[model samples]
Target chain A: GAGVSQSPRYKVAKRGQDVALRCDPISGHVSLFWYQQALGQGPEFLTYFQNEAQLDKSGLPSDRFFAERPEGSVSTLKIQRTQQEDSAVYLCASSSHIDSPLHFGNGTRLTVT
Target chain B: SQKIEQNSEALNIQEGKTATLTCNYTNYSPAYLQWYRQDPGRGPVFLLLIRENEKEKRKERLKVTFDTTLKQSLFHITASQPADSATYLCALFKYGGSQGNLIFGKGTKLSVKP
Candidate 1:
């Protein structure tokens, strides 16, 4: 696909379990971002990467949430000891430039029961 | 802390009428504002962008106006149609040191009835 691609469209995890979400950004895109959207709410920023460098992770809810864009192409968001509050749609977006319009993937919906 | 607000309540309008959505912000002025449309179960798609220097920008039937002094932006859709019904999100572009992030409003759901 030409747009950003995300895997495991839906995931149901038991509380205290771990899960990892994957995102493949558009080819040659220099910027990638992760956002978490709760039901009926807008997406909240989680982290941002410029190629292989993780520039920002300020919006992450807690230390349990971590993300990495290894080799500057594919990225992964991992949650350890997931809690019920971790349930949300995780969205990934890519842009060719720092200030360009973002192209977003449909997103991965994670439910922690 | 910066805050963005959009009407949490849905906006109902008849087809063929014009639909206007408002977005307001406080605590900081942004360099630009972006509007996006999101359908059910889909990701947000970029609609229009208005810079601080430019008061208004238009593309096809979509128009966006930015008022830096007022810290508000208005999105207008002319000739509303059923297909135009969706949740519209307003984002403020905040620049800090070397990185920029978009702070988004909760979004306003627009319903165009035929």
Candidate 2:
């Protein structure tokens, strides 16, 4: 793809249900990132991947949140036992390199009821 | 604790005027700072980046100034137009941290009136 692509533009799940969001970054990009944005708030870091390596998962709010980029291209963010507080837009971004500007996806708006 | 603050109120300016937005941070040293523009229901688009060692940067009608000592950055849009109306965000890359760990301010919404 010419830019980062995210799937499931919007999702509504009941509390305690599990959900998965997908991201397909720009071709050959070396860095991929995941962020969660609440209404009226800036995007907050969730995880980062350098190719297939999960270099940082320090920002994940809890064990219920998990992300992986196994092949260094497509990534998935899965939330288990979702809570109402988990409702937010999940954004995916990729950069050509570690120091380059990021290209972001339109994001998936998740609403946990 | 580290904190980033941006103008809490929306800025309204007439077209052809210059729009200036402020971003301030505390309790952390950032290697670089960046500015982005976002529209409603859309993701933020990258604009400019300034390193700590650099004082300023410019791209076309956009100008960004970074002051590490004061932990502040100012973003200016010259000859603003109604189409330029959007939320501008300020992000900081922490020193010695991965780029994916960028910290962002809540952003300032700008409205340009014709």
Please name the candidate that would achieve the greatest DockQ relative to the true structure: 2
Best by lDDT: 2
Compose the digit string of candidate 1's lDDT tens values, residues A1-113. 69999988999999999999999999999999999999889989889999999999888889999999889999999999999999999999999987777899999999999
What DockQ do the predictions score, one after another? 0.67, 0.70
Supply the TM-score of chain A against the true chain A for every candidate structure.
Answer: 0.98, 0.99
Give the per-residue lDDT digits (tens) of candidate 2, residues A26-109.
999999999999988898989999999999998899999999999999999999999999999999999988878889999999
TM, every model:
0.97, 0.96
Q: Tell me the tens digit of each residue's lDDT in model 1 across B22-53.
A: 99998878888999999988889999988889
Q: Rate the local accuracy (lDDT) of all candidates.
A: 0.90, 0.91
Docking class of 2: medium
What's the CA RMSD for each of the models? 1.3, 1.4
User: B1-114, model 2: which lDDT tens digit per residue?
Assistant: 578999665899999999999999998778889899989888899999999999999999999999888889999999999999999999988745743658888989999999
CA shift of B53, model 1, Å: 0.2
Model 2 complex DockQ against the native: 0.70
